[model samples]
Target: MDTPNRLAAAVSPYLLAHARDPVDWHEWGDEAFAAARRRDVPILLSVGYSACHWCHVMARESFSDPATAELINRSFVAVKVDREERPDLDRIYLDAVTALTGRAGWPLTAFLTPSGEPFFGGTYFPREARHGLPAFTAVLAAVSEAWRGRRSEVAAAGAALARRLASPPPTADADPGPDALGAVYRALERDFDPVHGGFGEAPKFPPAAALEFLLRITDASDAPRAAPMVQATLAAMADGGIHDQIGGGFSRYAVDRRWLVPHFEKMLYDNALLGRLYTRAAQVTGDPGVAGVARTTLDYLVDDLGLPDGGFAASEDADSEGEEGRFYVFTWAEFLAASGDAASLAAPVLGAAPEGNFEGRIVLHRARPAEAVARDAGTDSAEVEEAVVAALEGLRALRANRVRPERDDKAVAAWNGLAIRALAESATVLGEPRYLEAAVRAARFALAELRRPDGRLLRSRRAGRGDVPAFCEDYGAVALGLFALFRADGDPAWFDQAGGLVEDMIDLFGDGTDGGFFATGRDAPSLIARPLNLSDHPTPSDNALAAEALLTLAAYTGEARYGERAAAVFRVAGRLFEGAPTAVAHLAGILAVALAPARELAVVGPAGHPTTAALLAVAEESFRPDLFVAWGDGHCDGGIPLLQGRVALEGRPTAYLCRGHTCTGPTMDAAELRRLLTRRFRLSDGERRVGP
Candidate 1:
């Protein structure tokens, strides 16, 4: 029997995974470092998340082995960290790993001095030497030996890293303008897999933020390129195995370029961000298929991830029954058996090779586009799509009896914030009241449960305790979510809540000297140096989300201070905007929003008035990614600046369209308001496309 370690009391599932490991694993904190100092040994830090598959593989192959565990236990004080729960440690260590190794990925292994400055690290290692990499045991022996015999050199290296992290980063002169957007677009075009529909070759993530950037750049000049990429990527991902045909929502990423064979974890942030992008894309391109995809994803969130009260789970694990992709992949026989009458059409559409695509089983990806399949099956595309939807419904029911993947039920505040914003925004655009209700529930829960009375937001919740104070992303994203809810429902209290959260964020994460938000809060535990997050990885950066929230808040309140605060961030990370900007897509999008002329839309009338409701719906459904909007029914108490002097004209619903705080004459008719909004902004190339 294996002995339990200190992680047995931990809240993180990733840490608890090793609770029974033979190694004397310690949870990350001063206690672990104290032990390292007391023993005069280096610290071995392993960072990963619960949903990470490679982390599981490393645990099974190396950490679980008694011989390898003995070496780790004896030579160094082993510390386990879940990246999701403690992104600060992850950020600091990951940067050190990248600086030392030129690349970074999970199952992050770092050797730190007792004082907690990283000196050496790599990713996964096998128990014995393989793939031209040293064995875990061998690496441990060398690091331990160096710590003892070469103490002066190790201490010097640690001191050097400490200094490097402590130094402030140099600011860039360039602002992200049209020139920067074009450069990033051209780079994406160059790297885009024309055949597969993603930016890179394989291991393809959905590029959610980049797609959003494209959605925002919908001027005539950008549409020609951005439209095609957005459509192809959304279509390919929806048609591929990465999207669960039976269950809704998307897998973490496709392992292949063609969106087949995913890593299998379904993350709340991925679906939330992607749902917003798809709905926006559908509004822009008028693609019903794309809209259907967005709707399906939203429904999945409500059904699968949403907790009974309102908050959402962090992630669904990739592995099931101790095997990767086991719950999702189907045998050829099972696929045909489930299809029955439609087997002839469904078999070809589902890409079921006789020997299977992976591990002797079909991963259920689209073998060909539905249009081509329609041509071959002697039917129209619409009829084929109907048949395919029916077939998938049957398969979904069939798979219900299969062992489901494990779900990590912890509700992290930042991810729920992303979900809330997506759901609330989609509710207005997609005309779904249920989504709005869900968003309200989530926002209310976040404010009530995940926040302290002192106005500090907590990181996560499990069972009942909410202990961890929020990071930068947690504060920014939750505040943005509340802002979106306020916009959708016209509630003054939501606006008030959002404003308070933003002020708290500015107080906690804002860098007074440098003028941008840091990744961790002022109250967060001390590390070697506070990480300044400027890049978006998988999700939007803490800094960029803050910039976006602040910009929107400024527009709503007519506050120049908020806008000025966001501008300071642009000054610091502007070089990244010109160089490799697509990777930092959230920042790039916000910069465009700040630079472009913003339109504040105010509709004034009673909610019970028919004409006002119609005008509001039209404005709500329009593709106005750049618009700051408010709905007022003869009231200035809505708390939006656009509603301050707005009034209904002659007891008729009136629409006020303004730019740079200047409004046009009030219009009563919805059609006239539409025309005014339509005529307000013309494309740079003098070509007009439909929708806002």
Candidate 2:
């Protein structure tokens, strides 16, 4: 019962759990390496994030044991890294581990030389070797003996590993056309689960970025293949247990092929990205189901996760009172007690039998359509839906009284920026002013609390602490959010703030010599090698997003510099697409914008100009990711390529459609504006030039 002495003093909860161990523990930094060199011992590097379940298991079983800790402390300079805090470190090390061992996961246990070159690595070694893997203690003893006695062999192996890690295989770009996009789609199709949505088998993650890429490709080319892939995936996710039926958001992912069992963690980034996708999907397909999911996700943020200052909280833990999925899973008896007659009606449709998905606890799901449930109950579908809602409301109240999962209330600037953008976009699509207001408030809070005195943004703030230096993602994402705010509201100040951040990002994070931006700023901690991860994770990489942000800023501000910067970043990483196209979807979206004709609509008139409103409505209704809309007033600059010299016609609100510097005649009617906007996509370029 005594506090573990090893990591008890550590700030990270995961590290604290191993505090009382016999092993000597060192927080990741220069001090750890210095001590290793002084003691003439090899280094043991452990990498993992806070919410990782197996990471906790490994810590409890091995790191906290006195015998194990003693061995580790004596032979190795044991270091612990919170991967979330230092993803650049994690990236290089993970790549090293994967290369050395041919596999990777967290709590990543890797053996490294004094200079920090990994020679051996694996994930989740048992306290005692079992399951066709070496026991942690035996592996430790063998490695330690080898380090002391077989120094030459260890050094040679370390040298080879270091070389391999240093030199990644080349990604050539011999062909650069739609074929590259086709290659990604082919990969997705190969791994696609036809019965359920998403790629691969069990433990399916929401591929929001990849799906968004497909959606954009389909919309641009009118490709039917991509559309169905997207629709099927979205539909499966919405209907599955991965979606919280009682709550408003999605779990981290489904643990099974059917999307019936989830890992139970709810991440802020997942909800933000998924919300935006659903909103856009609804716009594209006019599917009310997609709209419902989007609305519910936004509501969850506003009602449960929104911070007092307007920024959203980071995550909700998967474990509730030391048990995973405890807050969500329920027994049949518990459901019956809570639902009364409603349970009888819903039970048959939900497959709520005595034996359930997880040891008699049924994770609620809809096995049949609402109409089928309605038919079985001899009621209207609407009535059945209302009854189901009422039952869920009651169940939610009961569940609230039970023990809840610990909420991670840290406000991350990058994630909050994502939430802000999603909210603003959702507000516009769903016609909800409160969502817009929430977005504006969060943006204001971020600007106030997340910014340093010198105007550089901070990455995160928690427990009244607010000085973590912001990375590229924070600056780029917030800038994107600010641009979204500018579009949602006709405020030029938001645009100004966004533009300022873009300048700050370039000044601080730009690799002036090579081109693309670095994940860490010039003043941030130095790693073995500065890495640029363009692949999308739960969120897009900072570099890919930076390109997108720059392109968007260019569209809105009429700044050619922004466009040039975006193009340069894309070109710098152009070769990377040959091997890792999935990571560069954000860049791909930006490229699509570049290849297409840039369309900017300028509505010049009063704030409530009816004609302006009509044109604005038309712009909103149409799903054009590339289109930028702005209201033109005397205070607002009209020199933007699409707005300059665009005068109001006959004292009425007028819209100007401009490509490059040339503008068409001002139109006051919504029909005329739609015609102008759709003309290019509807007709061949040659035909359009001939005025057919």
Candidate 3:
């Protein structure tokens, strides 16, 4: 009945969830720091995002207690930060935390000096002492006493850690070469669970990046082992409880090795990345089942998480009604109540019983394959597919009536960009206009809501307000999305937007001293040091992705500047090739284009030209991000030289394939176009080389 505390007054849903906690919490900003300085006390910096499950537990057990709050409020200045909102702050602090403790994770509690120097940090602490860990109160008292009694020692230690963070270990150019792919394969083979399919012992993540890398390597080299790894991972993930069997899309991760139980949080990035991966796998293996999962995941995004404004929502929380997995898990009686005889067919496959895995319920999983299910039902595969479809349809409606996870409605520019790329790619593969429409709508939403008057873009928008100057990721992602839109829809405006954004990004984030883009903008607030991370996280880094976007734009528009800029970015990071080649996958895409023949395709005619439509279809259907297409009455003015002056052939639907300013004969036939595209572009032996 009492009024909630400071966090309740905050805008973020994650922060508001901890509003009622007795610990005096202040959102990360100047006020929190000023308070710490005024009290001359150390600060307890807690950094986490809303979707982190352990973060929730720590808040409920420790911060929510009156005693815990009193000690924290009395002894230290407590500041809470949503890492999603301020990634720059998170990066700096996380680096320090990792340096001091040799590990880091969510609900990260670090003791920092008033000036923001971190002394010590760790993850979740219990309300009372348990599991051989000190109690929250005891830890707080000890830290507080140490700060007062040994100020010089603590300061000296913090200073030393700061120096170590300031200068990371010197990296050598250890070009792991193509062998890095082999290394990853060997690593996976060593850790992979034979029965479950994913790597590691338990608490399995989808590891979409690793899977994607493998797919790329396999596709390029014609490696047989690569195909099976892709197949096994996809099959296992599709059949696991980590996937919502009744609905579409997957949960965050599996809590157990067998993929029987999941963490229950569904992220837009995971689904988007996995959707693209599965779609590609389906194409490679010629498996309809894999494609079905991809389609279903896309359906979930459109049906549930799609914003009317066109962007996808950030994530679905893991908890519902204060209980994790309650909304998703179902008991045998509950399953029967939802679907009568339909439940019988799924019961054995899903291991649903009177008592469930977590409580008295069952978390659905496919312990058997679709073929096995068909065999058990004594029916054809097609009949089994129909039955499963009917059962899922019935179950989805019932589940919709129950509680649903909280949706983070904030549309992030970078995440939406990733979703846009996924949707555009899916549109081509599935031949679905709806997906393309979704991609275009999201792109439009971003341009409308996130752009500033001066042409600068913002990082995120929530509840109709856009704040925070766009980071490198924001510019790079939105630009990449726009390029995809241009390819999918053949709108020249998308190309124009992408071009303008790239120019702006180069001006704002480009390292003048070197060449690659910095993570933060020139006008943004200064940190201890600017981090130029190229490693892939849930999404690729801005620098790496920007290179990809630039190369694509160049190929389409025929602007050598774009390609030149991409090369410049690679050269800047070339010195670290051996140390972190995987971080440079985007750069790899660009390099592939450079080494191979560069083709620019243009189809000109009326919007409804049958020939033009066929050529456009061919363009979209191909997995060649290196290729660019344009449809119009005229060629792009600053377009690629290969496409310049080329117009619609014979005033009918016609296509032109150009390489290096040389135009091939125009044709309206799809078969002829396919013949032109099928010709492989080989690299000269001398030209084939890695970056600096």
Q: Which ten contiguous residues of candidate 3 have the minimum total lDDT?
A: 168-177
Clashes of 1: 0
| Tens digit of per-residue lDDT, candidate 3, span 92-177 | 78878888878887778899887777898877888878898688788899999999999999988887777666553233243223
Ranking by TM-score: 1, 2, 3
What tens-digit string does per-residue lDDT give for candidate 2 at 180-249?
5555666666677788878888878888987887776665443446778889999988888888888879
Each prediction's whole-model lDDT (CA):
0.84, 0.77, 0.74
Query: How many clashing pairs per prediction, in order?
Result: 0, 11, 6
Q: Estimate each model's TM-score.
A: 0.96, 0.91, 0.91
Task: Tell me the tens digit of each residue's lDDT in model 1 across 436-538.
Answer: 9999999988988887777678899877764777899998899899888877888878888888889988998999997889988887878899988888987
- Give the range where candidate 1 is weakest over 10 consecutive residues by summed lDDT: 683-692
lDDT of 3 at 94: 80
What is the overall TM-score of model 3 with all chains considered together?
Answer: 0.91
